[model samples]
Target: MPVEWVIDQIKAPDQSGAFSYASGAAPFCEIRLWPNRSLPARGFVFFIAATAVMLALPLIAVLGSPVWWGLLPFILGTLALTWFLLRKSYRDGAMEERLKLWSDRIEVTRIEPNQPETSWSANPYWLRLALHPNAGPVENYITLRGEDREIELGAFLSPDERTDLYNALESRLIAVQARK
Candidate 1:
């Protein structure tokens, strides 16, 4: 679940009964919906190291062979490409969609790698969580609709994850509406 959603209750005397959902990357000062990374940095390093060692083994026997010159670039290029992609993935891993739901309003904020934060808001009473199992660019795409706007919720999540998110959001919104 690289995309995550969490609900928290506001506990201050003035804001009693207010509910918040920190989805994506909201500051932990409250709660946040954040990414559940499938690969850790350490694991990535270990895997790359193992791969490099394995790839180097056969090449060691071919050292100084005329073919080695041609093979060397391909080997180094492949490793370099792998390292670049892995580093890029790690760099983008911090991207998140933060959704905050309170009694009166629902706000969604997105933070992407090296990008400015973008946000959308709607009244909780009028907000809708929609799941299009066959529509959009991906399967089980999820979107949120407000009175005058609509936005995708978790495009980074897998289809199964989007389904889970849809169910949780449907329930949470209903609960918040009821309490309001």
Candidate 2:
């Protein structure tokens, strides 16, 4: 799970011993979400090195022959292409979603590589969180609707994670609404 609760203060009390629920502009909860990455930087380096070694193993037999020279360029090219494609995949996966829940409002911001950033915000009172199990592009799709606008949330998350996120969001929203 790549979801991180950056700031969780939904139940924090103020100096007066009251829930800080709509007392200020500060958000009660803030969360950041990103797609799970299996290959980290260290793993990537190791993988590339291992690939180079494996790809070079066949060259040992032809080391003193002209065949090695002929195969060297092709092997290097293949390795280069593999590295390039993996790097591109890493770049394409560079995206993040941030959700901030304030006393009176909820806001979501999406940051994607090589694309314009997008944001949405609305009053929590009028907001609704929806989870679609089978009718969406992905299973357990989650969306937030408010202020005459609707936005998808955690679309990159797995089905189970999306369901968990929906549950968490629903409960948190309910708690905030209760204070209103």
Specify the highest-TM-score model's number. 2
Candidate 2 ranges beyond 4 A from true positions: 10-24
Consecutive 10-residue window with the lowest summed lDDT within model 2 = 12-21
**Candidate 1's error at 149, in angstroms?**
1.0
Question: Distance (Å) between predicted and true CA of 133, model 1?
Answer: 1.2
lDDT for model 2 comes to: 0.87
Each model's lDDT comes to: 0.73, 0.87
Tens-place lDDT digits, model 1, residues 1-180: 554445444222233243444333332122255556777879998988988998788788889998888788888888899999988887877887877767567878888889999988888888878999998888998988997888987887788988987887776677667765
lDDT of 2 by residue, 1-180 (tens): 989999877563344214343565557789999988999999999999999999999999999999999999999999999999999989988999999987577889999999999999999879989999998999998989999998999999999999999998888888777776
Candidate 1 local Cα displacement, residue 42, angstroms = 2.2
Model 2 steric clash total: 0
RMSD to truth, every model: 4.8, 2.6
Most lDDT-accurate candidate: 2
